[model samples]
Target: MKPVLIRLLLLLAWAPFYTQAQQRFSFEIEGGHFLKDGKAVPIISGEMHYPRIPHQYWRHRLEMLKAMGLNTVATYVFWNLHETEPGKWDFEGDKDLRRYIETAGELGLMVILRPGPYVCAEWEFGGYPWWLQNIPGMEIRRDNPEFLKCTKRYLDRLYEEVGDLLVTRGGPIIMVQAENEFGSYVAQRNDIPLEEHKRYNAAIRRQLADAGFDAPLFTSDGSWLFEGGTTPGALPTANGESNIENLKRVVDQYHGGKGPYMVAEFYPGWLSHWAEPFPNVSASWVARQTEKYLQNDVSFNFYMVHGGTNFGFTSGANYDKDHGIQPDMTSYDYDAPISEAGWVTPKYDSIRNVIGKYVDYVIPEVPAPNPVIEIPSIRLTGIADVLAFAKRQEPVESPVPLTFEQLRQGYGYVLYTRHFNQPLAGMLEIPGLRDYATVYVNGERVGELNRYYNRYSVFVEIPFDATLDILVENWGRINFGEEIVNNRKGIVGPVTVNGMELSDWFMYRLPMDGAPGPDKTAEVRAGTPEASFLHRKPVLYTGSFNLSETGDTFIDMSAWGKGIVFINGKNIGRYWQAGPQQTLYVPGVWLKKGENRIVIFEQLNDGPKNEISAVKVPILKELKS
Candidate 1:
């Protein structure tokens, strides 16, 4: 294999990361799916994100994926990960998307690029940059002149960096999506007009073509013939919504009535969140569809071959009660064949057997599984009894009002504070508080406004000569609804306290970047560990374990709360006490010859220096999430 280096740098914005780009790629598009240049490419693609998985395991994961007979790799371009602010973009470290695509090229695989200014990959803000929320009067995901205008600008900027990588242009990318599943949900037109949708779709295609991306631009839809289907120039394509028969209909419809088929989203698993029961997508005869497709010569991409971490507040959710309004959990362990900790789940072996039939080379042996951390349940005190550490710090600026986009932060809470110049009494109303809110009068907690129920306003009573504060926690934005998607965190509308509207001067910032580690002397509060309550939150816990041998171990995290895990300072991404993701993987490379330190930040449980043991990967029966 040639040496490959990838730079996630946003090109000319940040100093470039100096990683090798793969020297070559092989791709050929016939009726549709890309085949190796000289061969009839019966391609297999899997969806996973380099940013989602730990940076260190990119190659290991890719190698394993390829072994599964997946010749094509697909990933989403999380705009937030690149451009947190409008002009500033970071493609280095965890944000190194460029390196990822280029590396996939190096691995002799073709790639599908899902560069959505709004990719609803269960991401914090559906992959749209937070800055969009600050555009004043901006209507996102809609065809509003303002919305499309910004969309064009973002697309233009993005194309400038990777436009040349399209497959038609001889680059690794075979397909590029024009906004994920737009046809399946409420298009700006569905709520507005059909003409608007057509125009919006046309305009997007024009922009992509104008920017010279050259690759076929496809739209991913759960519904096949609604309008958008993938064939690009001919018709757009559709991924079956967890149903193989339906998937065939969509793919067949795209090929002018009949042909081989594929599912852009062959569900390897399902997504879940905090307040709900586990949303499980287990293996069964339906799960056999993956093997079935391969056996039948159909080309498809696993929506998420490897579900990675929704680290920080990057997880997303649907607002509709039918789908439940809770935000997604921090851990995105989609019950994929390849576990988030990077283990080869039993599901992996099952799919590999199904795919092994068509591959040219002998399937590479799956790497030995990582060690599992067999966490022994134990409880700790005093740490929970410690005093609040952040209340004493200067505290993040909160007197000035801010929006989720303005702060350049995504999912999570934002606080806005301002002292009332004159005192007045009436029903104070904040026409909107984005999603959720907690009101404080002179630093004393008063009450909170809840939006989990579709309420539009929060009424608070404020007094004279007092500093009124509104702490808005991001309960999660609406991922499955038709309303305000640009629905960011913080105060979304007018602010009124006690029937008196207060204007001018305010402060804001999530202060959720995380606190200054753990303190020996700190106090803890219950009922709000997962949300940012500042000082009342739990302190980080750190410990060391001696590995009798330096080997890969999946840190058994079944006993912990939601937060991140690190081995000897190497981040293994986010984890949750939630089942299905009870392990935070620690590759042997990050281990020490004797002892290794492991640090954890439990968002909920404040207990124990638990013991960990490596465990087996979990896959859906016929597939699992």
Candidate 2:
């Protein structure tokens, strides 16, 4: 036979095998059980946000979940991380949802996509783009026409990236969540009519369907909140729920008493705020819960088998009648089965043992631990004052203080300057201070106001014709509860002196989107004296450390007060002396073999020593009295 004819015959013989391997399958919730290809399958899943974990570590984290006997990997697609600005969409690099989903499928694991227009995953603004607040007549997560229109556009754009990866399209994505925890929001919001909430949720569901997300849809909320959160025709799932009886009852009540029940967000550990003690769930208790879930045939997903770093300005705030504005700590660790740096904990082993007993197939061995390294302390010299950099930019003039949203600024600090015509001394009150503010009178730091404690007023003594600069840092937008709608960073309303309102402001946009480089530092250092640079204020410090080899390391900012750290131009995360999180996780993949740059935008480094050490472990809790 001729070589060409033989090759053609071989290709024809293999065609069917290849086609079958890539064939799509039906995934349905029927007879109270999850049916994949007409066979009942128990979904043991774990939640891990793609944006939270570095793109390079996605496979390792997913593998960890599979080894723990989780057949599925669930993730929340952060919209803010994608469309950072209005009309500017990004689905590349770390923000690539398609690649992440495809990677999971390649590893023989299914995906549960929770692409929320409002995820409320301790993410800034519940994953809503900052520009959404700037739109006229915009009301988020509600029946507002502008919000609905924007949501449709966002979902349409998202589907363009991952629509082909749906289970119906030969992809691993079996189910998708429609609007996260809407029932909680509806319950908290009393002013908005219940009918309006229903309309908004229905609109989100329609939008998801219209965007070609043909996978089975589910709505996750607390068991009691199914009434407000569940959309018509979508399966209702519970969060933070374990009782099989209650879970079945809620799902049956909202979803026609069907059998396939799922606890969409089973909380193994709780989220931590800056000042509060780091929350830790007992490993044995979690194991017990897992056994209960499996024994009762109730499918469950660990809210975060591995809660990666929040990185950049992504960590969000939580506000309620009891807690007020509690901004989430940068380290999203969640104290899950898998640590923030991808290290398996006792919880991981506990959960694995529980799952191994129930699964029919052999669980894969846990992958080897990632390498971790420690570097000696590197001295970071004060190179620039944040306000000094702000002075270089032309200020936006307004009669009253404007918000970070009003100025079209998303994250970081915004310097609001007001020139006092005469010497004014009184209780200066900023009624609309969103989060944290540092008051300065003519380059002299006076006092500070923290929104976390609801302290928006401070005593200020202004010099004649002095410039009153209120440099406000946007800790993060409220990600949970009803306060999310009221989330406008920086100065939102009027700044009053005693009982009178102050006016004539010069707002400098210090969004601090990127770390200041040597060129910027040189300019500030050369222009200012060393004596003036050591003041207790927000200062930019720069330094470099040599590394022979790279591995995962934590940048210990225990010496520093509060600030954001950037390594090799990458925004690692924020650090504060407020306790609970003292070190920022720096993935070794981001480092080079030789010299690596580190920049600290220190908000309050009062001590003489200006240094940070690359430690081996994380310091999650250090509660100050």
Candidate 3:
């Protein structure tokens, strides 16, 4: 064995008592309780993802969590955010995992790190790196050789950064989850065999141990997942907002009638998707549910004390067996105690009061809310032709339509264009359109296709022989269940016209990371979209707004169709006129005192006014689903 490998193994062997002589901060599981340094300490944690929030505001949000009477903060380390591409890893800036954890520790807050190779946090590809899909026959979240090899490397890198930071090594991290909600998915989806599911869970626990994580590793799942998700050594924990009786019963039964009762994910409010209203679990409901758990002396963590934003193209979707694909909204304001803009809601006050009644220590005062500003309508100038941008792209010729992964593309839309020899008019079938697409023939918009409702094929009529362009947008990947195993975006099958499949296509990778500089943008007054540009062709609308003072505000994007927004140079997130989310939250930290640039990549715009404004408050809850 290599010297470094031997040294790491030795360190793993001494993990239990690595820092015992210096600090008495051990967190171990005993009979129905978590013994912190041999004293029973109730863990009241709240889930807050760091990548979703700005790195500058992590401390501010942590303070709010502390004031809410939460002793611990739980967060999932999204693997894809760090390893955007295979063999290359990033742990700096917003992707810095150690800094977030260390900051929580500085504030005297314990940590529960859920570093799942597959987190399923409504994040893109369930936190799996997109490059994983490019690997031949790569079966993820399974006991596959290639997948495990990659997973081991990732965990090893994670341990190198935060291993010594574990509670066993005098750090604030009390516990770490083996994998997130795998049991719930196995039972519900059953994509893999039962024995393989069991073996996969055991293998993951082993890999976590080999990676030098000597702290108590546990499995988190819903009440029904114990049978499939729990292993022999790892403690079993349930997740839910209410049903305290059932939660305790299942967990107790799983551990052979005696074990620590931990609700790893107690949902105060649920996740929202595009076109659906934001989830609205009442503050009273959360207070009552928490009181029940506290009354029973059961420990729990609020799923989202503050859900920031999905930001960029990291949001994931859900593929239901009946309802087809449901793409998640960009704003991850999980309607929790703390709002996305870091404001304390009524739910925060209610949770604090209820938690205070149970804990002996005094709850600190809630942190003051952040300031917000409303700006007048900002007129959009400079219309940059998107087709011109496409002309500069290097096109790949393929026999049939190729998936985004097949072409080595990560996120954003892909343009698939082909010229037909003869005039054609019939039903165009894209059997495997992953998400949404816009069909155009001879530079004219034909129809729209959506994956959410399973609109796979669209009828079209063409006058004569002309070029056909099918621009497909990758909204997001499925984050959960069996479908996620192969959630590759773009068209995976041939484009059939009148039952005849077409061949020889030009594929363009539009990751939309950014665009050409000022030379590409045309300086013009804001009005209806220029008729010269095709309606289906993507347009880059650029504008600037001057601000004397800056604070957190929401940009009203209701006027725009489905597309992405960029403030200055930073990519904010996607915006859809779909009912639920109509605005994008803009943190003041991203803004400056002088002129701030704004760019919108609109896919379709049928609205009258072409203006963007700032609102003081975020439009969180809209019409219900």
The model with the greatest lDDT is 2
Write model 3 residue lDDT over 201-228, tens digit each, in one string.
8888888999999888888987787898
Which candidate has the highest TM-score of all?
2
**What is the number of backbone collisions in each predicted candidate, taken in the order shown?**
55, 4, 0
Better of 1 and 3 by lDDT: 3
Q: List the residue pairs that clash in candidate 2.
A: 32-259, 32-260, 252-257, 580-620
The C-alpha stretches of model 1 lying farther than 4 A from their native spots are 1-26, 31-35, 144-149, 186-189, 228-235, 241-260, 321-324, 371-412, 415-471, 484-486, 493-508, 514-625
What's model 1's overall lDDT? 0.61
Report the C-alpha lDDT of model 2 over 1-625, residue by residue, as the tens digit: 9543464466456544533555467788788889999999989999998888889999999999899999899999888888877767777788978779878887888999998988888999889998888889898888889988888888988876677678886778999999999999889997989998898899999999998898899999999998899999788989988788999888888877676888999999999998899998999999999999998888889998889999999999888687578889999999899999999899999899989998998899999978999998786654676777888889999997888888988999899988777998999998789888888888878888998877889998887988888889999998888778888888888889887899889999977678888777543442246735557767788878899999999988877788898999999988878877988999989998999998888777475445669899899987762
TM-score: model 2 vs. ground truth: 0.94
Residue 81, model 1: lDDT of: 73
What is each predicted model's overall lDDT from 0 to 1? 0.61, 0.86, 0.83
